[model samples]
Target: MKKTLLISHNREKLLNALVYFSKSTRFCGKTKLFKLLYFLDFIHFRETGRSITGLNYYAWDKGPVPQDLFHELKQPDTDLKETIALLEQSEDEDYRLCRVIAKKPFDPKYFSRREKKIMEELSFVFKDALAKDMVEITHLSGTPWDKTMKEKGPGKRIDYSLAVDGSKGSLSLEEIKERMSEIKEVTEIFGDQ
Candidate 1:
Protein backbone atom coordinates (compact mmCIF):
# COMPACT_ATOMS: atom_id res chain seq x y z
CA MET A 1 0.00 0.00 0.00
CA LYS A 2 1.13 3.51 -0.79
CA LYS A 3 1.88 5.74 2.16
CA THR A 4 0.14 9.08 2.69
CA LEU A 5 2.13 12.29 3.01
CA LEU A 6 1.75 12.15 6.77
CA ILE A 7 2.86 8.53 6.97
CA SER A 8 5.91 9.25 4.82
CA HIS A 9 6.69 12.16 7.06
CA ASN A 10 6.34 9.87 10.05
CA ARG A 11 9.12 7.59 8.78
CA GLU A 12 11.57 10.44 8.64
CA LYS A 13 10.49 11.58 12.08
CA LEU A 14 10.98 8.08 13.40
CA LEU A 15 14.48 7.87 12.00
CA ASN A 16 15.48 11.17 13.52
CA ALA A 17 13.87 10.26 16.83
CA LEU A 18 15.77 6.99 16.84
CA VAL A 19 18.98 8.92 16.41
CA TYR A 20 18.06 11.44 19.07
CA PHE A 21 17.21 8.84 21.67
CA SER A 22 20.16 6.70 20.73
CA LYS A 23 22.53 9.56 21.37
CA SER A 24 20.93 10.98 24.48
CA THR A 25 19.60 8.03 26.42
CA ARG A 26 21.53 5.59 28.59
CA PHE A 27 19.62 2.55 27.44
CA CYS A 28 17.03 2.24 24.67
CA GLY A 29 16.09 -0.88 22.78
CA LYS A 30 13.06 -1.77 20.69
CA THR A 31 10.81 -1.99 23.73
CA LYS A 32 11.98 1.27 25.24
CA LEU A 33 11.91 2.92 21.85
CA PHE A 34 8.32 1.83 21.33
CA LYS A 35 7.29 3.28 24.67
CA LEU A 36 9.11 6.53 23.91
CA LEU A 37 7.30 6.94 20.62
CA TYR A 38 3.98 5.99 22.21
CA PHE A 39 4.39 8.55 24.97
CA LEU A 40 5.62 11.25 22.61
CA ASP A 41 2.75 10.77 20.20
CA PHE A 42 0.07 10.37 22.85
CA ILE A 43 1.25 13.28 24.96
CA HIS A 44 1.43 15.54 21.93
CA PHE A 45 -1.89 14.24 20.74
CA ARG A 46 -3.48 14.95 24.07
CA GLU A 47 -2.09 18.47 23.99
CA THR A 48 -2.36 19.43 20.32
CA GLY A 49 -4.58 16.74 18.80
CA ARG A 50 -1.82 15.36 16.61
CA SER A 51 0.81 12.62 16.89
CA ILE A 52 4.49 13.38 16.40
CA THR A 53 4.72 10.44 14.07
CA GLY A 54 1.51 9.56 12.32
CA LEU A 55 1.94 5.98 13.57
CA ASN A 56 -0.94 3.71 14.52
CA TYR A 57 0.03 1.65 17.54
CA TYR A 58 -1.22 -1.79 18.48
CA ALA A 59 -2.00 -2.80 22.03
CA TRP A 60 0.54 -5.58 22.13
CA ASP A 61 1.14 -7.75 25.18
CA LYS A 62 4.27 -5.78 25.99
CA GLY A 63 2.70 -2.36 25.47
CA PRO A 64 1.81 -0.07 22.57
CA VAL A 65 3.85 -0.86 19.44
CA PRO A 66 3.95 0.78 16.05
CA GLN A 67 3.73 -2.45 14.03
CA ASP A 68 4.68 -0.95 10.69
CA LEU A 69 7.97 0.37 12.03
CA PHE A 70 8.41 -2.85 13.99
CA HIS A 71 8.30 -4.85 10.77
CA GLU A 72 10.62 -2.45 9.01
CA LEU A 73 13.18 -3.00 11.75
CA LYS A 74 12.85 -6.75 11.45
CA GLN A 75 13.73 -6.69 7.77
CA PRO A 76 15.76 -3.57 7.41
CA ASP A 77 14.76 -1.49 4.40
CA THR A 78 17.68 -0.67 2.09
CA ASP A 79 17.36 3.07 2.61
CA LEU A 80 16.93 2.62 6.36
CA LYS A 81 19.82 0.18 6.62
CA GLU A 82 22.05 2.77 5.06
CA THR A 83 21.07 5.35 7.64
CA ILE A 84 20.51 3.30 10.81
CA ALA A 85 21.08 -0.08 12.36
CA LEU A 86 19.49 -2.04 15.19
CA LEU A 87 22.42 -3.65 16.89
CA GLU A 88 22.15 -7.20 18.18
CA GLN A 89 20.97 -7.23 21.78
CA SER A 90 23.74 -8.06 24.15
CA GLU A 91 23.24 -10.15 27.26
CA ASP A 92 23.42 -6.97 29.32
CA GLU A 93 20.60 -5.09 27.66
CA ASP A 94 16.88 -5.78 27.58
CA TYR A 95 16.53 -4.48 23.97
CA ARG A 96 18.70 -3.89 20.94
CA LEU A 97 19.95 -0.34 20.59
CA CYS A 98 19.02 1.56 17.43
CA ARG A 99 22.11 3.31 16.11
CA VAL A 100 22.23 6.07 13.56
CA ILE A 101 25.16 5.09 11.34
CA ALA A 102 24.20 7.26 8.40
CA LYS A 103 26.62 9.62 6.76
CA LYS A 104 23.94 12.30 6.83
CA PRO A 105 23.52 13.69 10.32
CA PHE A 106 20.12 13.82 12.01
CA ASP A 107 17.97 16.65 10.72
CA PRO A 108 15.17 18.06 12.84
CA LYS A 109 13.59 20.05 9.98
CA TYR A 110 10.49 17.86 9.79
CA PHE A 111 9.68 18.40 13.45
CA SER A 112 7.79 21.40 14.72
CA ARG A 113 9.11 23.38 17.68
CA ARG A 114 6.63 21.59 19.91
CA GLU A 115 7.58 18.23 18.46
CA LYS A 116 11.26 18.79 19.12
CA LYS A 117 10.50 19.95 22.62
CA ILE A 118 8.48 16.83 23.32
CA MET A 119 11.21 14.56 21.98
CA GLU A 120 13.78 16.28 24.13
CA GLU A 121 11.55 15.99 27.17
CA LEU A 122 10.94 12.32 26.62
CA SER A 123 14.63 11.64 26.18
CA PHE A 124 15.53 13.52 29.34
CA VAL A 125 12.80 11.89 31.42
CA PHE A 126 13.52 8.33 30.33
CA LYS A 127 17.24 8.55 29.74
CA ASP A 128 18.31 6.23 32.52
CA ALA A 129 15.01 4.40 32.92
CA LEU A 130 14.76 0.75 31.95
CA ALA A 131 12.59 -0.71 29.25
CA LYS A 132 10.47 -2.32 31.93
CA ASP A 133 9.99 1.08 33.50
CA MET A 134 8.79 2.47 30.20
CA VAL A 135 6.47 -0.52 29.87
CA GLU A 136 5.02 0.21 33.31
CA ILE A 137 4.37 3.79 32.28
CA THR A 138 2.44 2.75 29.19
CA HIS A 139 0.52 0.15 31.16
CA LEU A 140 -0.85 2.77 33.50
CA SER A 141 -4.59 2.69 34.09
CA GLY A 142 -6.81 4.92 31.87
CA THR A 143 -4.09 5.09 29.22
CA PRO A 144 -4.78 4.21 25.59
CA TRP A 145 -3.01 0.88 26.03
CA ASP A 146 -5.09 -0.01 29.06
CA LYS A 147 -8.31 1.03 27.31
CA THR A 148 -7.49 -1.04 24.25
CA MET A 149 -6.46 -4.15 26.19
CA LYS A 150 -9.48 -4.01 28.47
CA GLU A 151 -12.15 -2.89 26.04
CA LYS A 152 -11.02 -4.13 22.63
CA GLY A 153 -8.67 -6.93 23.68
CA PRO A 154 -4.94 -7.05 22.92
CA GLY A 155 -3.38 -6.92 19.43
CA LYS A 156 -5.96 -4.32 18.48
CA ARG A 157 -5.19 -0.92 16.98
CA ILE A 158 -5.05 1.55 19.84
CA ASP A 159 -7.29 4.51 19.18
CA TYR A 160 -5.07 7.35 20.36
CA SER A 161 -8.01 9.72 19.87
CA LEU A 162 -9.13 8.32 23.21
CA ALA A 163 -6.27 10.26 24.79
CA VAL A 164 -8.38 13.40 24.86
CA ASP A 165 -10.63 11.83 27.47
CA GLY A 166 -7.94 11.59 30.13
CA SER A 167 -6.93 14.28 32.65
CA LYS A 168 -3.29 13.65 33.49
CA GLY A 169 -0.92 15.98 31.69
CA SER A 170 -3.86 16.66 29.39
CA LEU A 171 -5.92 19.68 28.50
CA SER A 172 -9.54 19.98 29.53
CA LEU A 173 -11.93 17.76 27.61
CA GLU A 174 -13.63 20.75 26.03
CA GLU A 175 -10.30 22.21 24.97
CA ILE A 176 -9.24 18.87 23.57
CA LYS A 177 -12.35 18.69 21.51
CA GLU A 178 -11.65 22.12 20.05
CA ARG A 179 -8.08 21.17 19.17
CA MET A 180 -9.30 17.98 17.59
CA SER A 181 -11.68 19.90 15.36
CA GLU A 182 -8.97 22.35 14.35
CA ILE A 183 -6.51 19.54 13.61
CA LYS A 184 -9.07 17.69 11.52
CA GLU A 185 -9.67 20.78 9.45
CA VAL A 186 -5.96 21.36 8.94
CA THR A 187 -5.39 17.74 8.00
CA GLU A 188 -8.18 17.83 5.46
CA ILE A 189 -6.78 21.02 3.99
CA PHE A 190 -3.21 19.75 3.68
CA GLY A 191 -3.75 16.01 3.25
CA ASP A 192 -3.44 15.97 -0.52
CA GLN A 193 -0.73 18.58 -0.89
Candidate 2:
Protein backbone atom coordinates (compact mmCIF):
# COMPACT_ATOMS: atom_id res chain seq x y z
CA MET A 1 0.00 0.00 0.00
CA LYS A 2 1.12 3.50 -0.79
CA LYS A 3 1.85 5.69 2.21
CA THR A 4 0.37 9.16 2.24
CA LEU A 5 1.82 12.07 4.13
CA LEU A 6 -0.59 14.11 6.14
CA ILE A 7 -0.26 17.06 3.78
CA SER A 8 -1.76 19.37 6.35
CA HIS A 9 -0.40 17.70 9.44
CA ASN A 10 0.64 20.05 12.18
CA ARG A 11 2.66 18.23 14.80
CA GLU A 12 2.03 20.96 17.30
CA LYS A 13 -1.70 20.58 16.79
CA LEU A 14 -1.53 16.85 17.55
CA LEU A 15 0.61 17.37 20.62
CA ASN A 16 -1.71 20.10 21.76
CA ALA A 17 -4.62 17.68 21.52
CA LEU A 18 -2.69 15.10 23.46
CA VAL A 19 -2.09 17.68 26.10
CA TYR A 20 -5.76 18.56 26.18
CA PHE A 21 -6.97 14.99 26.58
CA SER A 22 -4.23 14.20 29.02
CA LYS A 23 -5.91 16.67 31.31
CA SER A 24 -9.09 14.70 31.24
CA THR A 25 -9.68 12.38 34.19
CA ARG A 26 -12.44 10.36 32.59
CA PHE A 27 -10.37 8.78 29.89
CA CYS A 28 -6.70 7.88 29.58
CA GLY A 29 -4.63 5.39 27.65
CA LYS A 30 -2.86 5.21 24.30
CA THR A 31 -6.01 3.78 22.75
CA LYS A 32 -8.11 6.55 24.16
CA LEU A 33 -5.62 9.11 22.97
CA PHE A 34 -5.74 7.76 19.45
CA LYS A 35 -9.53 7.62 19.52
CA LEU A 36 -9.76 11.15 20.80
CA LEU A 37 -7.55 12.43 18.02
CA TYR A 38 -9.46 10.43 15.45
CA PHE A 39 -12.73 11.86 16.70
CA LEU A 40 -11.38 15.39 16.70
CA ASP A 41 -10.10 15.26 13.15
CA PHE A 42 -12.87 13.21 11.63
CA ILE A 43 -15.69 15.01 13.40
CA HIS A 44 -14.19 18.37 12.53
CA PHE A 45 -13.79 17.26 8.94
CA ARG A 46 -17.42 16.21 8.76
CA GLU A 47 -18.60 19.60 9.94
CA THR A 48 -16.17 21.89 8.08
CA GLY A 49 -15.08 19.75 5.13
CA ARG A 50 -11.51 20.06 6.37
CA SER A 51 -9.48 18.03 8.84
CA ILE A 52 -7.72 19.68 11.72
CA THR A 53 -4.70 17.36 11.75
CA GLY A 54 -5.03 15.89 8.26
CA LEU A 55 -4.12 12.48 9.67
CA ASN A 56 -5.53 9.35 8.11
CA TYR A 57 -7.09 6.67 10.33
CA TYR A 58 -7.26 2.95 9.71
CA ALA A 59 -9.70 0.41 11.10
CA TRP A 60 -7.66 -1.46 13.66
CA ASP A 61 -8.94 -4.06 16.11
CA LYS A 62 -8.73 -1.52 18.90
CA GLY A 63 -10.53 1.10 16.86
CA PRO A 64 -9.61 3.91 14.50
CA VAL A 65 -5.88 4.53 14.92
CA PRO A 66 -3.65 7.16 13.40
CA GLN A 67 -0.71 5.02 12.31
CA ASP A 68 1.69 7.82 11.55
CA LEU A 69 0.88 9.68 14.70
CA PHE A 70 1.61 6.57 16.76
CA HIS A 71 4.98 6.15 15.11
CA GLU A 72 5.74 9.77 15.66
CA LEU A 73 5.01 9.45 19.35
CA LYS A 74 7.29 6.44 19.64
CA GLN A 75 10.34 8.15 18.15
CA PRO A 76 13.29 8.34 20.52
CA ASP A 77 13.96 12.00 19.84
CA THR A 78 10.37 13.08 19.67
CA ASP A 79 9.90 16.42 21.33
CA LEU A 80 6.86 14.99 23.01
CA LYS A 81 8.97 12.41 24.80
CA GLU A 82 8.85 14.38 28.01
CA THR A 83 5.08 14.53 27.96
CA ILE A 84 4.66 11.01 26.59
CA ALA A 85 6.99 9.70 29.24
CA LEU A 86 4.64 10.93 31.89
CA LEU A 87 2.02 8.48 30.72
CA GLU A 88 1.35 5.86 33.39
CA GLN A 89 0.92 2.28 32.31
CA SER A 90 -0.17 -0.86 34.15
CA GLU A 91 -1.30 -4.33 33.24
CA ASP A 92 -4.99 -4.97 33.69
CA GLU A 93 -6.76 -8.30 33.52
CA ASP A 94 -8.19 -7.54 30.12
CA TYR A 95 -6.25 -4.58 28.75
CA ARG A 96 -3.40 -2.36 29.72
CA LEU A 97 -4.24 0.77 31.67
CA CYS A 98 -2.69 3.99 30.48
CA ARG A 99 -2.96 7.43 32.00
CA VAL A 100 -1.25 10.74 31.72
CA ILE A 101 1.12 11.65 34.53
CA ALA A 102 2.10 15.18 33.65
CA LYS A 103 -0.85 16.94 32.08
CA LYS A 104 -0.14 20.32 30.60
CA PRO A 105 -2.22 23.05 29.11
CA PHE A 106 -2.73 22.78 25.37
CA ASP A 107 -1.46 25.52 23.12
CA PRO A 108 -4.40 27.21 21.48
CA LYS A 109 -2.30 28.39 18.54
CA TYR A 110 -2.25 24.91 17.05
CA PHE A 111 -6.03 24.56 17.03
CA SER A 112 -8.85 26.62 15.56
CA ARG A 113 -11.80 27.81 17.63
CA ARG A 114 -14.07 25.16 16.15
CA GLU A 115 -11.56 22.40 16.67
CA LYS A 116 -10.95 23.41 20.26
CA LYS A 117 -14.65 23.62 20.93
CA ILE A 118 -15.25 20.12 19.62
CA MET A 119 -12.32 18.75 21.54
CA GLU A 120 -13.61 20.26 24.72
CA GLU A 121 -17.03 18.85 24.20
CA LEU A 122 -15.75 15.41 23.31
CA SER A 123 -13.45 15.44 26.29
CA PHE A 124 -16.36 16.19 28.55
CA VAL A 125 -18.62 13.55 27.05
CA PHE A 126 -16.07 10.80 27.22
CA LYS A 127 -14.28 12.03 30.27
CA ASP A 128 -15.61 9.34 32.59
CA ALA A 129 -15.50 6.58 30.02
CA LEU A 130 -12.78 3.95 30.08
CA ALA A 131 -10.50 3.02 27.20
CA LYS A 132 -12.50 -0.08 26.38
CA ASP A 133 -15.63 2.03 26.52
CA MET A 134 -14.08 4.34 23.98
CA VAL A 135 -13.29 1.41 21.72
CA GLU A 136 -16.90 0.32 21.85
CA ILE A 137 -18.08 3.82 21.13
CA THR A 138 -15.84 4.04 18.09
CA HIS A 139 -17.22 0.76 16.84
CA LEU A 140 -20.81 1.87 17.17
CA SER A 141 -23.13 1.56 14.22
CA GLY A 142 -22.53 3.82 11.20
CA THR A 143 -19.04 4.84 12.30
CA PRO A 144 -16.35 4.91 9.64
CA TRP A 145 -14.48 2.28 11.60
CA ASP A 146 -17.41 -0.08 11.63
CA LYS A 147 -18.31 0.61 8.03
CA THR A 148 -14.80 -0.06 6.84
CA MET A 149 -14.31 -3.05 9.11
CA LYS A 150 -17.50 -4.60 7.81
CA GLU A 151 -16.90 -3.84 4.16
CA LYS A 152 -13.15 -4.32 3.96
CA GLY A 153 -12.61 -6.56 7.00
CA PRO A 154 -10.27 -4.47 9.13
CA GLY A 155 -6.92 -2.74 8.48
CA LYS A 156 -8.65 -0.77 5.75
CA ARG A 157 -8.68 2.96 5.45
CA ILE A 158 -11.76 4.54 6.95
CA ASP A 159 -12.89 7.42 4.81
CA TYR A 160 -13.45 10.68 6.66
CA SER A 161 -16.87 11.16 5.10
CA LEU A 162 -18.31 8.72 7.62
CA ALA A 163 -17.87 11.27 10.36
CA VAL A 164 -20.01 13.84 8.57
CA ASP A 165 -23.07 11.69 8.73
CA GLY A 166 -23.33 12.07 12.52
CA SER A 167 -22.16 9.96 15.44
CA LYS A 168 -23.94 6.89 14.16
CA GLY A 169 -22.36 7.55 10.77
CA SER A 170 -25.69 7.20 9.02
CA LEU A 171 -28.39 9.76 8.53
CA SER A 172 -32.01 8.97 8.92
CA LEU A 173 -34.45 10.22 6.30
CA GLU A 174 -35.74 12.90 8.63
CA GLU A 175 -32.25 14.06 9.40
CA ILE A 176 -31.46 14.21 5.71
CA LYS A 177 -34.60 16.20 5.08
CA GLU A 178 -33.71 18.58 7.85
CA ARG A 179 -30.27 19.09 6.38
CA MET A 180 -31.76 19.69 2.96
CA SER A 181 -34.16 22.20 4.38
CA GLU A 182 -31.35 23.96 6.18
CA ILE A 183 -29.37 24.11 2.99
CA LYS A 184 -32.35 25.47 1.09
CA GLU A 185 -32.79 28.15 3.69
CA VAL A 186 -29.13 29.11 3.47
CA THR A 187 -29.28 29.23 -0.29
CA GLU A 188 -32.46 31.22 -0.26
CA ILE A 189 -31.06 33.76 2.16
CA PHE A 190 -27.65 34.01 0.52
CA GLY A 191 -28.77 33.63 -3.06
CA ASP A 192 -30.43 37.04 -3.13
CA GLN A 193 -27.70 38.73 -1.19
Top lDDT prediction, candidate number: 1
The runs of at least 3 residues in candidate 2 whose Cα sits more than 4 Å from the true structure, single-residue gaps closed, are: 1-9, 86-88, 102-104, 166-193
Instruction: Compose the digit string of candidate 1's lDDT tens values, residues 67-99.
Output: 988887777765566556666556656544543
TM-score of 1: 0.81
Stretches of model 1 off by over 4 angstroms after superposition: 1-7, 92-104, 165-169, 172-193
Alpha carbon RMSD to native, model 2: 7.9
Would you give me the overall lDDT of model 1?
Answer: 0.78
Model 1 steric clash pairs: none
Writing each residue's lDDT as its tens digit, candidate 2 over 69-142 gives 66665562334664454455667676666565443566787777888899999988888888888899998988
| Clash count for each candidate, listed in order shown | 0, 1
TM-score of each: 0.81, 0.74
Model 1 per-residue lDDT at 21: 72
lDDT for each candidate structure: 0.78, 0.72
In candidate 1, how many Å is residue 161 off? 2.0
Cα lDDT for residue 164, candidate 1 = 78
